[model samples]
Every structure is written in structure tokens, then in C-alpha cells.
Target: MTTYNTADHSDFVRQLYAFAAHIRDPKKNPCPEALEERRMKIYRELFYNNVESFISSSFPVLRQIMMHERWHGMIRDYFANHLSHTPLFPEIPREFLKYLDHERIAQPDDPPFILELAHYEWVELALSISDEKVEIATINPKGDLLDGIPVISPFAWSLSYRFPVHKISPDFQPRAPEATQTNLIVYRDADFAVHFIEINAVTARLLQLISSNDHKSARTLLQQISVELNHVQADVVVRGGMEILSDLRKRQVILGVRV
Candidate 1:
């Protein structure tokens, strides 16, 4: 009997990886032409269906908004070309987001906010499954809402996109805003379902400051915004913004201060 040497074993392993890649890409396969054709039909159906299901569950609205052909084509392109970080099924959605962030699939004719909308759609599933646990610190929720704030939850993320993604609908297909920017807040609430909040520029900046532990007072944050929108009153802005912060606190989204 002949024994396979290390070099032979290595070659076999390399080919296995290559075969897996080819199975993933409908354009490539290692089997004989007739057999390869049959195998590919099964491979393509299973691979595409799994990814499509994962993405549909994560972004139902986005899936609904896209034409079936367009959605299938995008998923096929992603499965064949995008490099995934994990083989785990649950991680596929995150990999899909990573693919969108890096892949410039947005055509000029496509909605300007297509990528943002995809992300907005994915945020809910990502937060629902996020394993990161927040350690809520003790702080006086009633304590001067403006004074010496601590930290935001690691699980909470604030984002800005150039498109008003939240407004997208089958009827209201969005274009890039004339204003040039839109802001969003994605946070896990006490119930653990992710909530998406559309916020204005000032509130976005204030949350950014608080998240960064900038140690700035609410007045200072409003003043910073006031500098941009000349002639606006900091006091009025702070008062309005505090209401948001207070609500965030009540929801347990703001995880209290570090002190």
C-alpha cells in the first residue's frame, strides 16, 4: 500500500479549499463538465437560498423594496466574491454588512442612500444578537441632567449617513437629501430589541461628544453647534436636547456615568 506524504496531503487540503471556493462561485467548478453542471445547480440553489434567507430576515423592508432579480443578483455577487470572516451561520449577517461597506454596488441611478438603507435595515438584527453585555453603573438619574455625565453603553452606536434612510418605503424611494447629511441613533433598549431613532445634526453631535467621554457640559455642546448655525441660542438648544438625553436615560440606553 502507498502512503500519502506531507506534500501530497498539503496538496489535497489546498484543493479542498479551492473546491469549496468554486462551489461558492457558480462560475467555477472542478468536476467533469456534465457532473459539474449538475452539482452547480444544487450548490447555487443551496448557497443562494441560505444567504438570501439570512439577509431577508435581517432586512425585511429592504428586501421588500428591492426587485427580486436585483436582490438575488446582489446576494449571488456577495456570496461569490465577498470574503467572510466566519463560517458560523449567525455571523453571516455581519459579514453581509461588511460586504456592503466595502463593495461599491451603488450605481449612480440607484438611490443615493442604498448603502445606508441596507445598514439601517441590518441594525435591528445585529443588536438583537450582539453578545456584548452592558454593566449599568449607579448614578442619580435625577441628578443634574446637564452636569458631569458618565458613559454611554458600548452596545449603543450613533451613526450618520448622507441619506434619510428611515424614510425609505416602497412608495417613498429616497434620494440623497439636498441638505447633504442625516443622523441616526441605534441603541438596544431594555426590552433588547434594537431601536432606530432619526436625530438632527445637533443631537447627533451631542451624542457623539457624550459617547466619546468628552466631558463637555450640555451648554458647551450646544455652543459648539451654535457656532455652526450662527445666531442660535445655546440655552434653547440645550433645553431641547436635554429632553432627548433624559429620555435616553429612562430607556437605559445611556448606561449612566463612570463616576
Candidate 2:
């Protein structure tokens, strides 16, 4: 009997790849009409339905807008083209969003804001399932609230989008706003449920700077915003901004400001 060497194993591996690919999509195989045709139908349907159900459950609102055919087509294309990072079925939604971020789907042209909206939509469940716990260090609440650095929760996310996705209603499918952008702060409250708050540019900057571990004083943060606005006196903005910071600290939104 002849022994099979590495070259023989390599040939076997290539053939195996071909066989598996053919079984995955039997239409790609040049097998007998009866043999491959029967299996192709079952395989295709199973693949399409599984992905469709996964996406539909995760993005019910997006599913509601598209017709059945259109929705399934999107999933079909995603499964066929997108390179998934995880083998776990539950991670499919995350992979789908990753695909959407890069792949142009076959529907109403998804605006730039659509990516952010999808992420925002997905975050509710993502946060619920996330295993990473935030360990916030203790801070003196009565001390210089601005002096202590504020650390936003690791799970918390701040997003600004061209469209007001959160405000989307049955009657109104939000289009990209022409006037100004909207900012949203998504954070898990003390109760552990995720909450979203609509915030202004100033507040967004303040939170972002604090999260960045920037060493600027709360007074400096306000002064910077005031100068950027070319407002009257810096003290007025600083005083008001400190009050806002104090409220944020009280709410536990700002972990703490070092004195």
C-alpha cells in the first residue's frame, strides 16, 4: 500500500474545501441534477431564514419598514458577502452591523446617520448582555467637584447624529436634519438599566473632555466654551458650568472631579 505524504494530504484538504463549499451552496457544484438540486433548496432556505430571523428580532423597526422580500434580500447579501468575526449565532447581529457599516445595502440609500441609528438601536441589548463591569473609584462629593476628574462609565456611549433617530415615530421617519445636529448620552444608571439623555453641544464637550481624562479644570472647561462662543464674561459661564457639573456629579453621571 502507498503511504499518503504531506502533498497527498494537501490535495485532500483542497478537495475537502471544494466539497464543503459545494454543500454550503449546492448550486455551485457540478453534481448530478437530482443529487445537488434537492439539497440546494434546503440549504439555501435554511441559511436565508436563519439570518432573516436573527436580524428581524434584533432590528424590528428596520424590519417593519422594509418589505419581506427586501429584508430577506438584505440578509442574504449580508450572509454571502460579509466576513463574520464570531461563530456564535447570538453574535450575528453585531456582525450584521459591522457589515452594514461597510456594505452598501440594496434599499433606500441609508444615510450616514443610519449607521449611528443602528448602533443606537442595538446598544440597548448590547449593554444588557455586556459582561464588563465598571469599577468607579470613590470620590468626595462635597470637595471641589470640578477639581476631581470625571470618569464616564466604560459602558456609557455618547453619540451625535445628523438625524434625530431617538425621536422617530410611526408617523415620522426622521430625515437628516438641515439646521443642527442632535447629541445623545447613553449611559447605564445606578439601577443598571441603560438610559439616554438628549444633551447640547456644550454638555457633550464637557462629558467628552472629562471622559478623555483631560486635566483641564471645570473652570477652564467653561472658559474654553465661553471663549469659543465669544460670550461676554467667562465668570458667568464658569459659574453656570460648575453648577451643571455639580448636578452631573450628584446624578453619578460624572464619577467625580479631583480637587
Please report, in order, the local distance difference test score of every candidate based on alpha carbons: 0.71, 0.68
- Residue pair clashes in candidate 1: 150-257
* Tens digit per residue, CA lDDT, model 2, 81-146: 576768888788788888888875535654445566677778866776677765544554456765
Highest TM-score against the true fold, candidate: 1
Residue-level lDDT of model 1, residues 60-110, one tens digit each, is 777888888888778878877787768898888778888878974765566
Candidate 2 clashing pairs, residues 3+ apart or interchain: 147-258, 148-257, 148-258, 148-259, 149-258
TM-score against truth, every candidate: 0.80, 0.78
Give the C-alpha lDDT of model 2: 0.68
Task: Tell me the spans in candidate 1 whose CA falls farther than 4 Å from its real position.
Answer: 1-15, 30-44, 104-109, 138-140, 223-233
